[model samples]
Target: MAWLFSLSAECGTQTQAELFLAYFQKLSWTLQDGKTITTVPEVMEDNDGNWWCMVVPQGLSENSVKSDEDTPQMREIGNLLYASLWNAPDFRYALLGIEVDLFRTLSELLEDTTIGEQPSNFAGLVLAESIWDLINRPETFQIFKPGYVWIPYPD
Candidate 1:
């Protein structure tokens, strides 16, 4: 049997980090968090400044990390951030790189997003919705192939 591990995504900042440390007492997950992944990620940023957010910023554990790789807690915070940050029902999120500064506005994300035009380079915006769908239906992931773009959002 295959042993699959799902390392939860963390969100938030400093005080949140302190709170996670306090409550969990210790976090082997964060410590073991790798600087790499197994497969070629659908979304790869070539720019500099985009480190993933690990801080909640506000709320009781405002400065804490959303979870210590805990599934449920992290899911809630992740969803909340979706509504809190953008306030858009269909908003998609992506961890952008320093080069993201080129497009100051959110609408710019859709700029030149012709899926067929750049078959070699996948855009980060569409990758977000596609991944969320994959998270919900991982069975489809097994048949995933290189160069196959999955877009959950309708055209």
Candidate 2:
């Protein structure tokens, strides 16, 4: 079963939505067509009355990276790529049918302010390592594929 992360906010405010949009715009991501995405879909309420959005961050795709490669460098690249695409407006909107607002709200609730920031090349590796530690563990993850794991959010 897929686990959905719920935002702490009841019905996210417009201000929150705008902030998420701004954060995504700052990332300056480009689509495969080489066009920059300028907008994201609005936030919506889920079945459980929590605000949420879906995003298929870039590196999550089946072709993103070979999961068999277990090198430190490869793992770092995967994390960085996932983070980058996760914050992209297009990717977020396309996957979730909403926008980055859900992510921003979740980040605030989780006290992870740096979730949207672009990591420096040096820091990317470290961030990747940290990300792996968080999601690669079996206790917190659902088996999505042979080499891929999905981190389930707490209810």
Candidate 3:
């Protein structure tokens, strides 16, 4: 299956908001006490379509580096990606998207804070809300791509 991969890396003090917001919308949060929570954190998306936020959980486990190739920035990106993947709802919860973790790892790093600055290249971290937005618009996704998945649309 053809899949899209998104990754984020910091260029400086600015964080990637679009990447973060997309990840945010798809995440499901739970409390330490085992209670479920659905909190939509604050996001700033400009009129030109740039957005991001800081939603990293507190008291995360220590990060383990398996190779010398990992940089501090890369390590942090891995942490954000891990949090995104782990907290992501099952594919069933997605109306038009599927869970595709080409690979998985355990790592820790600080939350991204680089905003208002574009990176040279944004890989897997680029948001695909356009796809979701299209699908969500009154049977547009179904008409365009039939049988993509088995998720039932809200009637």
Candidate 4:
């Protein structure tokens, strides 16, 4: 279940990252149902070259503002936000488990796959299949857990 999300971005500029965060803060962000999803993004990195943030339905991560009933909505919202990165060639993301996060180019992610299309995270398919597909590669661990793997994506 997706209670919270650590969504980090590697945009061409800090403004892009800010715009990304700002996109969520707008009074809009509606879904197909004409309903809006709200996410309060807690930025972790802004001063640095990279941008990192934690997304919660309302409060910060430690507050655990999300509940079991909230998972479905969060999952859906997370899926939209996750896939939105594909809008730019430089944009990439890993829909990681609650404890981890990584950035990957859209091209890099589709590499060596039998199916050429980008795997949709429509409803958390990423949690099981995507994560497994990623971890299976011996080189992906270093980016997450220390001494693990790292599939370096082009900046």
Candidate 5:
């Protein structure tokens, strides 16, 4: 099974997506193109006008697993990077909506902390908690809804 994590934000603007991509690039995560590992994630807009930020490991297809060694690590890293966007200074003023959700398929892998799992999840949770801490309004953002992957369709 292909291991994937998707972060969907209702910002509805390519500008916001670009900003998020910039922030994500600064973190220096390893992105993969075919068998090559890159430093930037591939970002694009879907037909429904939603921007998708995806992390797809090499050797894995849309619905098949080619390797399991890196699935957990990828999911955790994806989660961390997804949450860190909210910490950007421009984030609050970007006119981006606050509704975000994290979808993943490796629940079992999340239990392993070999690759700094606690810190990753904790950092993400801290950012998430800060959302509620700084704002006194009702909850408008959420990271719920699991097991959903956004696969890009080939043209």
Candidate 6:
């Protein structure tokens, strides 16, 4: 928990962090359609890997936001956003995009084996299992913690 703020202070833009925090403080929620709901709609990471709170709609989810929702041309352009973190040679660049509020590359998605094709181990299976678990039991503490995970500075 201390790491959450300490890292934010050491690595983040204060103004941007504050702006996002203000936004996160304002969300209003209701249980919709009885889906599981552990997600909060107000976290973003800077290119520096510091987490900030940005107000996204409660309706947004990783799946929803990750989808190609733009016009066909835009979607096509966005498809270039494809790449994975674990499998790509350029995981560093993908990490940079994550820091900048950009779409994560598929190569990066490969990091979370749970979401990728034919995950090879229990870890990946566990992650995939958690996704469904969150949907089914949104209010569970096991699911709805704030989004704060550390990514080391690139070597």
Most lDDT-accurate candidate: 4
Cα lDDT for residue 11, candidate 6: 16
User: TM-score rank, highest first?
Assistant: 4, 5, 2, 3, 1, 6
lDDT of 5 at 108: 21
TM-score of 3: 0.24
Evaluate model 3: give its lDDT. 0.30
Positional deviation of 57 in candidate 1, in angstroms? 14
Q: What is the model-wide C-alpha lDDT for candidate 1?
A: 0.28
Q: Cα RMSD (Å) per model?
A: 15.0, 13.6, 15.0, 11.0, 12.8, 17.3
For TM-score, candidate 3 versus 5, the one ahead is 5
Task: Please provide, for model 5 over 96-124, each residue's C-alpha lDDT reduced to its tens digit, 9 standing for 90 to 100.
Answer: 11122322212222333432322323223
Over 21-48, each residue of candidate 3 has an lDDT whose tens digit, in order, gives: 4556565444444533332423433333
What's the TM-score of each model vs. the native?
0.23, 0.28, 0.24, 0.40, 0.37, 0.21
lDDT of 6 by residue, 1-155 (tens): 01010001111344555543453344333333342222232445656464443222233233233433322322221222221112211112221211233333223433443433322221111112233343332222122112212222212
Of the two candidates 3 and 6, the one with more favorable TM-score, higher being better, is 3
* Collision count for each candidate, in order: 12, 2, 16, 6, 1, 13
Off by over 4 Å in 5: 1-10, 29-39, 55-65, 88-155
Write the residue-wise lDDT of candidate 1 on 1-155 in tens digits. Answer: 21122111122233432333243222112112332112111111223322122222222133233344444343443333322323211212332211222232223333444433543343222233444343343222222123222322112
User: What lDDT would each prediction earn against the true structure?
Assistant: 0.28, 0.32, 0.30, 0.41, 0.36, 0.28
lDDT of 1 at 141: 21
Q: Which candidate should be chosen as best, given TM-score against the real structure?
A: 4
Worst window of 10 by summed lDDT in candidate 1: 36-45
Native-to-model Cα distance after best TM-score fit, residue 30 in candidate 6, in Å? 10
Worst ten-residue run, lDDT, model 3?
Answer: 102-111
